[model samples]
Target: MLKHEKKQYKKVVLAYSGGLDTSTIVPWLKENYGCEVVCFVADVGQEREDLDGIEDKAKASGATKCIVKDLREEFVRDYVYETFKTGAIYEGDYMLGTAIARPVIAKAMVACALEEGADAIAHGATGKGNDQVRFESAVAALAPQLDVIAPWRIWDMQSREELLAYLNERNIPCKTTLKKIYSRDANVLHISTEGGELENTWNPASENVWVWTTDPLKAPDTPETVEITVEKGVVTKINGKDMTPFESISFLNEIGARHGVGRVDITENRLVGMKSRGCYETPGGTIIYKALRAIEQLVLDKNTRLYREHLAIDFAQLVYDGRWFTRLREIMMAAADEIAKDVNGKVVVRLYKGNIDVIQKDSPNSLFNFDFVTFGADQVYDQKDAEGFIRLYSLPSRIRALNEQQRKQ
Candidate 1:
C-alpha cells in the first residue's frame, strides 16, 4: 500500500516582520519541511527603529533570501487616504490603523511570491487574530491559486513562553520575551497593544505599555491650534506648509502625539467568537478622523450625510474584518468616494491635553448659509413656514384622532 503523501510546496514566500513569530517561523519552516523560505517585508511607514536591522535577522533565521520594499508612499496615498475619505471610524474609536494596512501588505506579499516563482505563501498571523482573515482574504480575492500556510494553527508551540523557549533552544535570537507578552501591530496610522494587562478590564495600562504618546497629565497645559487644508478630499496643507501624503501624516502624528491626542481602550468583538481588549494609540489618525468628519458636515447635504453615516458603519466593519481587496469593499469604497466628492475644506483644530476639537471649518462646497439660519433676520427662509410644515407632517395622526372622536359621539 502506498503511504498517504503529505502536501509539499518546494518554495514559499513568507511575509516576514522580523518580529518574534516570524523570526521563529523562518527557521522552523526550513527544519520541518526542508522547503526554501523567501522572506518579504513591506515598509508601510512604521517606526524606522522597529524595521532597522530586520534584514540581518531574516538572513540569520536561515531564510534563503529576504526582500524589503518601501511601500510608504503607496500606503499613504492609497489605503490611508481611501479610508480617510470615508470618514469611517471603526467602533466609533478605532482608526483601523492595522486594518487599513493589511490589504496593501498582502498584495505586496502575493506579488513577491509570484515574482519569486513560489508555490505557496506563508504568514505569521495567528489563527485567533483578525490579521489571519485579512491576509487570507486579500490573497483569496487577488490570487486564489497560491496555497496559503499559517504556522500558528499547526505548530506545537501553543503559548508565547513555549515559542520563546523553542527559539532559545535553537539559538535563534528574538526580540520578544515572556514578561511583555502583549501582541502588538504597528503601522503609519496607529499602534495597537493586546493581551497582558490589557486583557483585564479593570487593570489600567502599565506605564511601559504605551510607546506612541505621552500621558495626558504630563502633556502641555497650553493648547495648540493648527490649521489644516484639504483639496479634493485629501489633506494638502498642515499649518499652511504644503506637504506630501507621507509628510502630512508623519507631521500630524508628531504634533498630535505631543498633545496626547489619541488613546483608546475598549473591549471589541473579534471576528472570531471572542471579545478582546485592546489599548490603541492612534494620535494622528484621531485628528484626521475629526477633521474629515467636520469637512463632510461642511460639504455634504443633510440626507447625504445621514445615508453616508449609515454606510460608514458597514465600511468600518468591512475594513475591520479584512475585506479590503474584495469586490464588496471596492463597491463600498466607490460609494464612499462619491459621498466624499465634495468634502473639500479647511479646518482649524485645537489640541489640548488629549482633547481634539474642531473649532472652525469652511469649505468651497459648504451648504451652510449663516444669514438663512440666523434668528435675527433671514431673506432666504420663512420661519412661519415651519408651522405649516409641522402640521402637514403630522396629518395622519391628526386625522385619526378626529375620526375616533366622531365615532364615539
Candidate 2:
C-alpha cells in the first residue's frame, strides 16, 4: 500500500457520476487524504436512472455533501450548438458527445470547488485515457491554484478486481458487478461504449453493447421522413414543432433511435496516443449533422463551403483534445460563425436502415439559381461565355503540356 500524505487538503470536490469508479472514489478520497470530499454531479442529460439515489450514495460513501446541478440546457445551447455550427466530427465520424460535454462539466466542478472553498479537485478518469487530460486541463485553465489529485496515478490498485476488493474492505457500496463491466459515457448528444469486448478490433459489437439505438436490421421497413428547420446554422424546429435546443435534440434522439439511424464502431486515435476501440450511438446527432450539412449545401457558396470543411477538421481535433476553453477554440468558433451567416434553411431527412437521407432542402438564403441551372434556353446566362472561360480555366494545363513537348524536342 502506497501511503498518501494525510491532511494535505481540508476539502476536495470530486466529479461524481454515481458510477462504480466515482462511487468507490468518494470513500477512498476521504480515507486516504483525510479531507472532506464534496461530490459534484452535473446532469448533462444522462439517463435518469444513473442520477437516482446518487446523492444518497455519495453521502453514504462519506461525502460531506453531494451537489447536483442540471446542466442540460446550457450544455446543448452553448457547447453542443457551437460544435454543431463548427461541423466538428472528430476523426471523420465521431460526433464528440463525450468530448463536448467535458469542458462545461469541468467548469461547473471548478465553480463548486471554489464556492465550497476546497483546496483540491478529483476525478475518477483513469491515467491512460484522454478524460484525465480533459478534466485537469480545464481546471488548470480556469483555476490554477486548485490541486488535482489523480488517484489512478498514485494508487496501487491496478484493476477493477483490486478496486472492488479495496471498496469491499472499507465497507463501501459499489453497484457495479464484474459481469456487467464495460466503460460507458452518455449525454444528450450520444452514448459511447468502450472496454470489455470492445478491446478487440476484430470483434464486432454485440447487440447488448448498444443502449440508445435499435439494430438496423431489426428496424421497421418503412422509411420515415423528419423535417428539421435551421436558422443561422442552429436547429430550431423538428417535424414542424418549435423546440429549444435540448428539447429538439431529445425528440430527434427518440425518432432516430427507433429507426436505427446512427451507430458506429471505430478504433479512434485517443489524445493520449493510444488507439481505443469505441462503439458510439449518435442517432439524434447524426440527423442534425446531416440536416445542417444539407442546408449549408444550398445556402453557402463553393468557396465558403470548402473553407468550412477544412475548418471542421482542426475544430474537431481541438474539441477532442480538450482545448475548448482556449483561445484557438474561440478563433475557430468565430470563423465558423462567419461562415454560418447564410446557413438558414429547412431539411427533410428520411431515416431508414441506419442512414439519414436528405429528401428535401429549402432555404431563403439559398444561392441556387434555377434559371441559370436549367437546361432550357435561358436569358440569364450565355452559352458562348463557357468557351472563353474553359480556355482560361485550362490555361495552366495547356501551358504545362506545351512545356513538356518543348522538353521532348
Candidate 3:
C-alpha cells in the first residue's frame, strides 16, 4: 500500500475530469486516505453538451461535493492571449493548446482548494504524462505550502486494463472498458485524442473519431476570406467587425472548423521522456497563428523579429516541457511581450480546404514602401544602387576568396 505521509490532510480537493482515472480517484481517496474529497472541474470551453452529466457523475463516485466553474473567458483572455502574444509554437507545428491550459487550470484548482480550506489538492494526471509536471510545478510555484496528491504515481494499478479490473472487482460503474476506449481531452480551443487506434501513426483516423471538424472532402469548395485586426498585441476584430475576445475566437473556430483548418497528428516528445501519438484540433488557433505572422511582417523590424524568433523556439520548448512557472519562461515571455508592442495590424486570410492564405496586411507601423518597391519608374531607388549594395553585402566573402587565392599563388 502507498503510505499517506505524516502530513495529515482532512479536506482534499481533486481535479476531476469525470474520466475513469479521476472517477476512481474520488473513491480511492476516501478508501485509502480516509478524507473528504471535493471534486473541482473547470469548464474551459470543452463542448459542454458532452459534459452534461459530469456533476452528478462525480457525486456518485464517492465525492462529498463537486464544483464546476466556468473559465472560458479567463482561459482565452489570460492563457490564449499570452500564447498568441509570444508567438510560441512547439516544434514549429503545434500551438501548445494543452500545455498552456494546464497552468491556468491547475492554478484555478489551487485557488479553489485554498477557498475551501483543503489541506491537500489532488490531480488525475498520469505519471507518464506532461500534465503531472505542469500540475505539480504550478502548485509548487503558487501554493507551495499545500500538500499535493497524484494517485497515478502512487497506485499499483498500472494500465487501463488493470484500472478497469480494479473498478470491476469493487462493483464500481465506469464508462470505459478493457478493450474499447480512447483517451481524450477537450477544451473550447481544441480536442485532443490519444491511445487506442491513435497509437499507430500509420493508421488513418476514422471520420467518426473527429467530432469537432467537418471532413475536408465534404467541406464547401468555395473559399471564405476573413480579416483579423490586432491592437496592443491582442486580436481586436475579425472581418472588419469588432468583437469581444470570446466572441471573435468562437466565431472563427466555427468558420475554420467547417473548412478543416486545424487537425494535427504527431508523435511528440513528452516531458516524462516518452513519445506519445496524439491528434489535436485547433481550428481558430491556426487562423490566429497565420494572421498574427502576417501582421508581424507588417510591424516587426528585421532584427527585432529575428531575435524574437530565436526566443520563440526556446520559449515554445519550455512551455511544451512543462516549465511554464520557471524564471526562464518569465524572462522569455517578457522579451516576447516587448517585441510584440508594435505588432498591431490587420491581416486578411482566405480559408480553403485546410489552408490559411494571407491575402492582405497593413499597419501604421509598416515599413513596406510602395514608392521604392514598385517596379514602375521610381526616383527613391535608383537601378544603379543595387550594384554597390550587392558588392558591399558580399565584401566579406570577396576578401576571404582574394586572400585564399593569394595564399595559393
Candidate 4:
C-alpha cells in the first residue's frame, strides 16, 4: 500500500487493547510481516469487561504471547497527577484522558519489545487520528533503533466493515458489529466516544454514546458534597480516608458519575490538522480539577497564578502534541512542580446534575487575609495611604491625560 517496501523483522510487540482495531491487528501483523507477534496490554484502569479473556483473545488471534502490565497506580500517580499539577485542559474541556494515556502505553510497549528481543513495535492507531502521532513519537523518543509498524497507514483496508471482513475471511472471531461501531478509549480518568453518528456535526449524540455517566436530567435532585485533601497539588484523600492516587480517582469517579458531574461534547482540532467531534466523560478528573483550582485560589498569588495559567496553555499543547519525553516537557513540568509546592489545602465541593461548585476551601498558605480588607474597619491596612498608592499606580495614565488637556488648551 504505502510505497515503502516491507522489511523482515524477527519479532514484533504490539500495543494491544483487546478492541476491534487491535484484535484485528494482532493477526494482520503476523500475516503481513511474517513475524512473531507479542501483544502488550497496558491496564490503565479501563473497564474490567474490556480486559476479561484478553490474553486468550490475543492468543487465538495469533499472538505468540500476551503481556498485561498493571499500570493503574503508575498511571494515576506519575502521569495523571503530574498533568493535573500543571492544570492543563485541552481546548478548555477535554481532561486529556486519552492523550495522557498514550505515552505511558507507548513506553511500556517499547520496554516489552526490548525484553522480548523484538526488533519492531506496532500500534493500531489510525493514520487520521492524533494517536498515530502519539504512539510513533514516543517510540522514536524512547527507542530510536526499533522499527515502528503502523498497519492503518500501510494497509489497504479503510473502513470498519473492511476490517471485520478481513478478520471473518480468516475465520477469526471479533466482537465488533455494524450496529455498534462507536470508537472508544477508556482509562480510570475518563472514557471517550467517537465515530458512528458523531461524524455529522448536526447529529446529536445519542444516549448510547455515553457509557460511564448518568444523564444529568435523570440524576437525583439532591446535591452531593465531597471533601478532598490536597498535598502538593495531588489529591491525597477523599472525604476522611487516605488513598493512593488510583484509589482517590476511583472513589471520586463513583460519586461524580452518579451526579453526572463530567460530560463534555466538543469538536477539537487534531494534530493532523482536522476537526473531530467527540463526547468525553471525565467524572473523577473533573472533581479533582475543581478541588485543585479551589485550593489554588487560596494559595497562589496574583503573578504566580498568572504564570501557571500561561504555563497551562503551553503544557496542554505539549501533551496534546505527544512531546512527553522531550526536555521541554521536563522543563515545563519543573515549573508546575514548583508551583505545586504551595498548593496544599482542603476543598469541599457540591455536585448537582452535571455542575460542580466549590463550597469551601482552606489552605495553610492562603493569601486571603480577612484583616487586610474588611468593611468593618481593619487595622492591618491603612485607608488614607490609598490616595498616594492609587496616584503612583496610575501615574502613566495621569501623565497622558494631562498632556491631552494641555494640548487642548
Candidate 5:
C-alpha cells in the first residue's frame, strides 16, 4: 500500500514590513514550510527610510518576489477619516494607531496572495499582541480558503534571542539587535511604542520612548494657533490652505510634532482581556480630532450630540478590538456620517506644550441662538416660562424626595 501524503502549501505570501520580526520571517517560512515565500509590503505612510532597499532585503532573505504598494491616500481618506467622524478614541487615549493600520495591510496581503496564486499567507505578529488577531481575522473575512500561518503560535523558536540566532545560522542579515529597547509600529496617523521600559507601570516613560515629538518641557515657548476648516467632518483646509486628506495630515504631523502636541502614556485594556502599557505620538491626529469635535459642538443639536457620544464609545471599542471589517462598524460609521452631516465649520486651535485647545469655533449650522441665551431682556424667551418647565422636568426627582421623607417619617 502507498503511504498517505500530507499536502504541502506550495507558495505563501507574507505581509512583510522589513522590520526585525518580518525580516526573519521570510527565511523561516521558506525553511519550515518548504514553500516559495512572496513578500508584500504596504506603504501606509511610514518613514521613507523604512521602505528604502526593502525589495533587495526581501530578495536577499529568500523571497521569490517583493511587492510594495502605497496605500496612504486610501488609509487616510477611508479609514482615518471614517474613524475620526465617529470620534473613536480607545480608552480616551490611544488613537488606535496599530489597530486601524492592520486591516489595510492585511487586505493588501490577501490581494497579493491571490494575484501570485499562493495557497497560504503568513505574518510576523507575536502571540502576545493584538496584531495576530487583527491579521488573521481580516484574512478569514476576506479570503477564507487561504491558509493562515501564524509562526508565533506554531514555531518553537521563541524570544528575540532565538529569532536572531535562527537568522545567524542561515547567514541572513537584519538591522535589529538584542539592545533594541522598544517594539514600535508606525504609520501615517500615529506611532506606538511598547515593551522594554514600558512594561513597568510605575516607571515614567523616559526620553528614549519618544520619537516624533519634542519633549513637552523643551517645547518652544511661543504658542502657535492653527486654524482648521471642516466640511462634513473632514478637514478641508489648514491655515487657509486647501489640501487633500493626505497632505493635510502630513502637514499637521510636522507642525504638531514640533510643539509636542500629542503624546500619551497610559495603561490600557487590550482586546485579549489583559492590561498593557504603551506610549504613543499622534500629533496630526490630535489636531484633527480636536477640530472636528469643535465643529460637532457647534453644529450638532443637544439630543443628537448626546446619542453620538454613546455611539462613539461603542465605536472606539469596536475599532480597538479590530472589528473594522464587520457590519457592526459599518452601520455605526454610517450613523456617524449622518450625525456629522452638518459638521461644517471653522475652528481655531491653540497648540502649546502638548496642549490642544479650541479657542474659537463657528458653523453655518450652529444651533446657538443669541436671543435665547442672552442674560439681557430677551425678546425670544420669557423668564416666567422656566417656572412651569422646571416643575414638569423635576417631577420625578420631586416624587423621589417626597417618598424618601415619608419613609423616614
Candidate 6:
C-alpha cells in the first residue's frame, strides 16, 4: 500500500458526492493527513434526494466548508451532447454514461480546489474502479501541481462496513447503511448499478437493480412515436417542441423511461484490465443515439459515414480509458464535429418494449434520390450506361481471372 506522511497537505478539496464513501472520506482526510477538508459537490443531475442536506452532512462529517456547483446544463450541453455527436458507444452496447460524466465532474472539482487555494484534491473513487483513473487523469491534465489523495489506496479499510464503523467512531452523521445492496452512479445521461447480485456473471439483474427505466415486459402494449429534430447532429427539438439541451434530455428521460427505452447488461473490459459486470439505464441517450443514426443514414454519404463510425470506436475507447483531457480527444472531437455539420434531419422514432425504431427520416443533404433509384424508366439514367460502368469496374477482376486461366493451361 502507498503511504503518505501525516500533515503533507495543509488543506484538501474533496470531490464529494455525499455518498457513504465520500461522507466517510471527509473526516478520514482530516484525521489521516491532518488537512482541512473542503467538500466540493457537482450537481450533474443526480437524484434530488442525493443532494438534499448534503452541505449539513459534509459539515457534520468534519468538512470545514462545502461548495456545490450546478453543472447540469453544462454537463449535458458540453459533455453529453458532444459525445452524442461522435456516436461514442463503449463496447457497442454501453453508452459511456459514467465515463463521459467523469471528466466534467473532475474539471469542476479541480476548479474548486484552485479557487479555494487548496494544495490537494481528494476523491472517493476506490482503488479498484475506473473512476480513480478518470478523476486523477483529468486532474493531472488540467492542474498538474495539485496533489491527489485517494484514501481507498492508502487506507486499511476494505469494505463498506469498516467505513461506516469509522464514521460511527468519529460521531459523524452518515445515513449510509450496509443494507444498501447496489453501488450506483447517476447523472443526467444515465444511471449505472453495480455490486450485489451483479457481482456474479450468471445472476440476472433483478427488478430492484433498475432505478431509471421500466421493465420491457411491463411496458405499454401500444407503441408511441416521437418526432426528433437534429441540427448539426445535436437534438434540437422533440415532438416539434423546441427545447434546450438539458430540457431535451430531461423530457426524453421521462418518455423513454416509461416505454423501457434503454437498458443494457454488459460485462465490459474495465480500464484497470479487469472484466466487471454492470447494468446501465440510459433511456434518453438511447433515443438520441437512434435519432442521430437515422440522420446519418439520410445525410452523410457512404464514405463519411464509414469514417465517422471508425471515429466513434476510437472516441468511445478514449472516453472509457479516461483520456478526455488529452490532445487525441480534441482532434477526434473536431473531426466528429465536422462530419456532424452535414447531419441535419428530422426522424420519427417508434418506441415499444425497450426498442427504438426509426420509422421515418428526411434531410436536405440526403444523397438518396427517389428519381435516380426509381424502378420505373426515367430520363436521368440509361440501362445501357450501367453495362459499360460494370464492365469498366470489373476490368481488374477480369484480368486477374484471365491471367490465372492462362497460367493453368
Best by lDDT: 4
Note the Cα lDDT for every prediction shown. Answer: 0.86, 0.90, 0.84, 0.92, 0.89, 0.91
**In model 6, where do residues sit more than 4 Å from their true spots?**
1-7
Q: Name the runs in model 4 displaced over 4 angstroms.
A: 1-3
Model 1: CA > 4 A from native: 1-5, 403-409
Predicted structure 1: lDDT = 0.86
Candidate 6 clashing pairs? Answer: none
Weakest 10 consecutive residues, lDDT, candidate 4? Answer: 1-10
Error of 5 at 353 (Å): 1.1
Candidate rank order under lDDT: 4, 6, 2, 5, 1, 3
Local accuracy of candidate 6 as per-residue lDDT tens digits, 77-102: 89999999998999999999899999
What C-alpha lDDT does candidate 5 achieve relative to the native structure? 0.89
RMSD after CA superposition, every candidate: 2.5, 1.3, 2.0, 1.3, 2.8, 1.4
- Candidate 1, 1-409: lDDT as tens digits: 1123336778889999888889888877776666899999999988898789988899888898999989888998899888887777788877788889998899999999989999889999888888899999889987899988888877767777887888898898887867766778888788888878887899999966788998888999999998999887788899999988888898889989999889988888889878888888988778877888898887888899888888878988989988887788888888887887798889999999999999999998998989977888768889889999999999999999999999999
Each candidate's clash count: 0, 0, 1, 0, 0, 0
**Better candidate number, 2 or 4, judged by lDDT:** 4
Model 4, 1-409: lDDT tens digits are 3346888888999988877788888888887788999999999999999889999999988899999999999999999999999999998988899999999999988988999999999988888899999989999999999999998889888877888988898888888786766888899999999988999989999999999999999888999999999999999888889999999999999999999989999999999999999999999999999999999999998999999999988989999999999999999999999999999999999999999999999999999988886778877888889999999999999999999999999
TM-score (all chains, Cα) for each model: 0.95, 0.97, 0.94, 0.97, 0.96, 0.97
Q: TM-score of the candidate numbered 4? A: 0.97
Model 5 earns a TM-score of 0.96
lDDT tens readout by residue for model 2, 1-409? 4446544679999999887788778877877787999999999999999899999999988898999999999999999998899898999889999999999999999999999999999999888899999999999999999999888877787877887887788888888776664788999999999877788888888987998898999998999999999988899988789999999999999999999988999989999898999999999889999988998989888888888999999999999999998999989999999888888888999999888899999999988999999999899999999999999999999999999999999
lDDT of 6: 0.91
- Which residue runs does candidate 2 get wrong by more than 4 Å? 1-7
Error of 6 at 236 (Å): 1.1
Candidate 2: residue 210 Cα off by (Å): 1.2
